[model samples]
Target: MIDFYFSKDQGVKVTTVNWRIHKLAQEGVITRISRGEFTLGSGISYSPSLSNKQISLYRKLKTEFPFLSICIWDTSIINEFMLHQPGRFYNLVEVEKEGMESLFYFLKGKNMSVYLDPSPELIRRYLSDEKDPWIVKLLITESPTQEVNGINTVTLEKILVDIFCDELLFDAQQGSEMDRIFKEAFEKYAISESKMLRYASRRRKKQELEIYLNDISKYRQQPNFIANK
Candidate 1:
């Protein structure tokens, strides 16, 4: 809005207004809310902390299947955005589908509770809230991931999409809590909507996710956005 006024009333270039906005944010005068959106609050970024168990499990899988693409992350990462976070959290290990069964057995051999691509029925029948378990799942091809401490981990974008799509698996992050989750996620992280939509498309939930995003966010329908990465 400031940029538009400057351009129309004072003949200032959009580039100059943008540069000013960037400099103002750098100096802490204004906060960047997505691309051009601005606010008074400070910026927040998402960073996942890896547990020893998560690290060790990732290493074992990497050593066993060095060529496979695997991502490891803990569900407790959502605690940063929740008021009713549960005491029990679990590990999520996603890899290509072909090696899923073998990896499940390998993990099972270690005497830890593990499940492979569980159904809602399986979750109800066997998954225990009293204990932490590792779930082996099929990693959607080209799902956004990053390497943290030399281990591949889930990105904020992927987590948002997963929670939106998997009601049974991510029951903890649903209903009213889901609204808060998405609102906090957008506020606290540099997430890319395009990347998230691509993953959702792979999961066949792109359209649904888009509608949900529109319902929850004002910036979701922006014509342009500068991805913060």
Candidate 2:
């Protein structure tokens, strides 16, 4: 939907092209579908609307660590794909490695239901039943993310990869439930397998997760999808 080179050849200034694109994006008439790629209409919506709690916490964190990368999401998003809902929910707060320790201690001191890089066993035993636990993990480099109202959250690609890789953290989403998750996600939104695989590679899940994704697509008879505008 965007043809910057063609526009430039037709005597459009680069700045003018960029400003028009920005205006369209602000109006939601077009959206950035990937890095350097914009689509003409509103694209798929992912994640539930941000709750007041989610927004407030993200703002507090941003004010304190303006330079750090962070993403936050509610566990309620998973419930849309889960058949057997767990008793408790969580707000996952993924941050850069350098900020993990400080944020963990800060949240801990405030007496929030917080855990830092919990083991699978630890999660299965204790935190699984606790209410609204805040799980902090190191954000993988190059994972795709988006910002809404200044709050950064994982992209659908990143979320699917995280569910695939972390068994302990997302235990309930395995097996048939995972199939449902993938199916529902694919049916509801646009997915970029290339983006997912690249992030999976960054997370050291390239080969295994690729096989898993391919297996999931076997019955659908679809072409390979990629991360492009």
lDDT of 1 by residue, 126-205 (tens): 77554788899999898989889899998888898999999988888999998888777776665667778989999999
Task: Compose the digit string of candidate 2's lDDT tens values, residues 149-227.
Answer: 7788877778788889987677778889888888777766666777888999998889998799768765232221222
Would you estimate the TM-scores of all the predictions? Answer: 0.79, 0.77
How many clashes does the backbone of model 2 have? 0
Query: Best candidate, TM-score-wise?
Result: 1
What is the Å distance of residue 74 in model 1 from its true position?
Answer: 1.7
The CA lDDT of each predicted structure is 0.79, 0.77
Ten residues in a row with the worst lDDT in model 2?
219-228
